[model samples]
Target: MTATLPFTPPLALASLSGEADADWARAGAEYAGAAFLGGIALDADSRAAARELVDRDRTEFLPDDPLAFIDRELEALAETPIQPAFNVRSATVDPVVDAARVCRDREAYLEINAHCRQDELCAVGCGETLLRDGERLARYVDRAAATGATVGVKVRAEVPGVDLPDLARGLESAGADFVHVDAMDSESVIADVVDATDLFVIANNGVRGGETVREYVDYGADAVSVGRPSDNPVVLERVRDAVARQLGLEASG
Candidate 1:
């Protein structure tokens, strides 16, 4: 896909939840000098999941004070040389508005998390549950976009019976700045998505190294993202070098 907005680093870090310390994790991510993506930062109003949410898989993060949590995370990353991105998930617009508004002020990308599959989130009509409600999801994206933050919507490419191209079109139609896709085991969806919409497409999943990054880039993704491997400085640097060569950005400059 043609990049709607230019990005020097085509490789970025994906949200890493289940970590012991969220802010500290994000700080380490930022310190890597590659682009950062904070793992699913819930909004102040996203407490809906607490009622029935079982912390299965141990990936669900419920902040005592989400705004404060985000504020601290943003503050910690303030010195990052490369612009970073933040992920936001909420069942309602007010909280997303709150989060995206702050992200706009801070010059960061605020991605709506339609990728989270925790059943707890599903009960609240947030997360991957939005995939079942495309219209609402589109409206949610539209609202997030109105905040003037760089708005992205991350989606799981292999959701049962969900039409990937159709969803991508809907998101783009609703003003999604980009669509970050967790393309599961296939890269073909990356090309399908790029062919389906004008919005920037970011390929994710199964990315183990710079060659993986190059593979996704060649598959028509405007960018690629890495998760756990980003925790390693050596691996992060290798990916960055490959991305710099692919995107022609300098490493030591």
Candidate 2:
């Protein structure tokens, strides 16, 4: 039998700069009811640096690996109340090896990123470029799923010549656990496309207020992924409360 999953909101940590005193646990608690951590950017140098950073605390840290570092940090934060989700960089075309390693070690539900529009990332044939080649994307999903990890894919919607429904169906067929649709700042267009997809829909696009989240959820999204807005408090208590209330209402009636 499939394990039951929580209906709490999934908060995404966008582009963290690794400040000296970043309190991830507190950050998680403040935003969503549960914590889904981000900021695991990997390149050859950065990956090595991160591994070394965790190694210093051998007793507290599990090992010099992606999953261990993430797990250790979460544990140290004592934020057991929230579930952990990770956002990592996919620097190569075939991200399966790294993706599987993370899933195995971190024990996380993997999210294959194909939505980042960064120039450097794009030049490397990562992110949204991955979408252009459906077969490769499918392979990555297949690889991640083979590790017994729940796999999700994030992609941009407005790419030229890219058919959203077709891509969604392909990803579904490739065995993705979820399809993260980047709505950017547009909601209506996203809602329309999301309604057409067969996979579990994670609507992400400037989702700030609860009302907008409600519209996405009501429109048939399985869940909503929100980012930290510059002006809003780090812990978006209002949004969290609103999501919880809406979920509760839905469950009851």
Candidate 3:
């Protein structure tokens, strides 16, 4: 059976490196059903990779204590109606499992990082490397799921040798609650992933208005999320309105 996300209207704010935090999520909460906070580095290896990315002028969360940071950030959103979720990157399974326990205790969601393509991250066996290493990624999902937190995987499209539909099936079998697909340039592939698994499908990438929103919904996406523009109220409004119209909810604008 396909698991359903607790939130509704099927719209989310995707994680944006150092920018997606509790404050950022609150800013987009009015327009979203869920908000993914962080691409937080949860282990020593992943933290090293995060530092490398920072050295390259990229943004990352290199918290001194990842679990404490997660708890504080998630706790900040405890009163909000919008669902809170953490998008995390880890080089090993244990940290992800530990992070999931925090999320479960906080009543938030946990999304494994498999969508990042940065060389620093992949070299450390985090991010996009997981996409190519389906078994390892499934292990992360399985271990995280064992903690009883709602879990999912964020994946990107168009990676060579990565069969996303097959990977989606593996994630479902590993007990993922959803699959957040960054349909880079392969929009049609969303349908394939949807058909391949019972996991809730969240389509991402260029989701700004009615056309994009309707396209993903028509392709059988269970939800849609905004990425870089997630903090833009105008874009969020447009997407929110579009989702409402597409989902037959009362129109927002």
Candidate 4:
């Protein structure tokens, strides 16, 4: 069954690191709803592994202490007045625990990134690597939730041989507040995830405009995220307005 947030704004920002500036102020101001910024690495190991790879459509800079780096990034946008959520990851659970501890009182979510497919990240048992280890991922989510900060798990929908429904159910059982799925081209995966878990489902991948936003919401996703279109200010605004119109919600700056 589908769930609803406390409030649903017309627009929601999908996590975007490459297009956003040092401070995500502009992205925050882009819409008054959710802003999922940064797929930050949470420890030295993951950072080093990620840094070893060439930059793709992602940010290549890796900080020695990734948690501290993300801390500053969040601090930059802390006062943005939107629903702020940061996507982060490591091979193990400690860094996620540490991040949740620090961001506990900030009301921001710490999202576990099981959505990245980078070769280097996968080599370190981070990113979509976790997708191959459902048991470990469950424990990881359990530890993150133990920190008392809101926990969300971002996942890739098209991983071969992976049972997406079972994984979503496991995450929900493990106490994830949100299960974010990059549905790729399969919107049916969104529906399956919704059936498998009661946690809020966030549908991503090729979400271009308000129509696509409504399409996912109609498919039982609690929310939807966009990538490339979010970089275009005018297009973003149009999409946001369209979301507002479709959802019968008011549009905001």
Candidate 5:
């Protein structure tokens, strides 16, 4: 059966630090029907200094290789009851390796990072730049699928020359399991892309509450991912109700 879209809060596990233990996962899973693990940032230089900073601030799971760190974290979460999914930051480097690791472990899903707009990341030809190179982006999707993992590519809409509908169709045709659109402050952009693609859609970016999520769902999305919003249970609770109502599921509250 196709996985039902999460109804409760839909735990959007904020990048690694956002979820430190099973309690966080359990809480999110209980409140949100699904959980999304925050992203693992990868740099071309594998900058030790940057990696150190991430380690100091993000999580204790940090490793010399950020990709390896992500692999280890997914392994650790394998025993948990909460369904797990991972997001990669600027997934231009060795995405296949990362997807292979996840596939080896049989994790729930793997998301590509095409939405991050960090200056440092963009400068390195990662993040949204991947979209500019449709050939490479399509190859990445093909590689991810070759790993036998459910692959989804997350992208920011509103980038110059980056047509959301066209990109979504490209990703879908390249074997992506889903096309994650970062709608951030653009409802029209979201609606346009949603209307254009038949692929599973995960709407994110600037989603503040149930009202905002409802708006996106109304536009056409299979599910909406909540990140910063998940930090506040009250807000997540509100979103949960909205998602439930939209999906015709019983509200937990």
Candidate 6:
């Protein structure tokens, strides 16, 4: 059976900065269906890349032991009503597998980042580089799935020559449970991806009010996630109410 999210309005808070920890998630728990923590760097190469991101004035989660960090963070959210998920970046497959095992034990979620377009991370083959290498990403998803954790991939839109829908299909075959799409400016692509695979689709980018939420819902997105402004109570309240209304509209139709 395909895995499902219990989000009533199907909205989530996207991981921002490696600083988006358990505390940040808890603060937004009442407004979110799930909370993604970290674009945590795992393994040596990805760690170095994360340091570079830090050098560029970006905050990253650079724990001495990433697996232990995952365990502790998920444990912190064990009592929170929101589903706790980790968004990880790794150049090697082993760290991803190990992290998935930790999430499995905690019954949290694991999201592979195929979304970050940072040149430093891409140079190490950790982020957007995976979008260009479908075979490797499928391998990562397949291996992570074997760990029995709920797995999803965060992908961006408008990458030159990359077909998002096709990629979603391959991920589904590889056992991914969901696809988190940062729909840059191509909001309609969510429909293509939804039609292309059974993986639950979470449409992201500029989701603050009824118009944006309704657009994604019209495009068939199963859920929507808030990014930079996820902590804004005004925005979250608007999105929450809009999504609930959309769900009601769908139910009545």
| Candidate 6 wrong stretches, greater than 4 Å | 1-6, 249-253
lDDT per residue (tens digit) for residues 95-123 in model 4 = 88888765565667777888888788898
Could you tell me every candidate's TM-score relative to the true structure?
A: 0.85, 0.73, 0.97, 0.89, 0.81, 0.96
TM-score of 4: 0.89
Candidate number achieving the greatest TM-score relative to the actual structure: 3
User: What is the per-residue lDDT of model 2 for residues 193-223, given as tens digits with 9 covering 90 to 100?
Assistant: 6666667677777667678778777766666
For model 5, residues 99-168, the per-residue Cα lDDT tens digits are: 5456446555677767656554566665677767777887888877666777777787778888788877
Cand. 6 TM to true fold:
0.96
Q: What do the candidate models score in CA lDDT, each in turn? A: 0.71, 0.57, 0.90, 0.73, 0.64, 0.89
Indicate whether candidate 4 or candidate 5 has the larger TM-score. 4
Query: After TM-score superposition, what is the CA distance of residue 74 in candidate 2 from its true location, in Å?
Result: 5.3
Quote the lDDT for 97 in model 5: 47
lDDT of 3: 0.90
In angstroms, give how far residue 32 of model 4 lies from its true place: 4.8
The candidate with the higher lDDT, 1 or 5, is: 1
Give a tens-digit lDDT track for model 3, residues 111-218: 999989998889999888988999999999999998888999999999999999999999999999999999987898899999998888999999989999999999
Candidate no. 3 TM-score? 0.97
Error of 2 at 78 (Å): 7.4
Q: Scored by Cα lDDT, where does model 2 land?
A: 0.57
The alpha-carbon deviation from the true structure for residue 196 of candidate 5, after best TM-score superposition, in angstroms, is: 2.0
Ranking by TM-score: 3, 6, 4, 1, 5, 2
Model 4: clashing residue pairs? 15-36
Q: Candidate 3: misplaced stretches above 4 Å? A: 1-6, 251-253
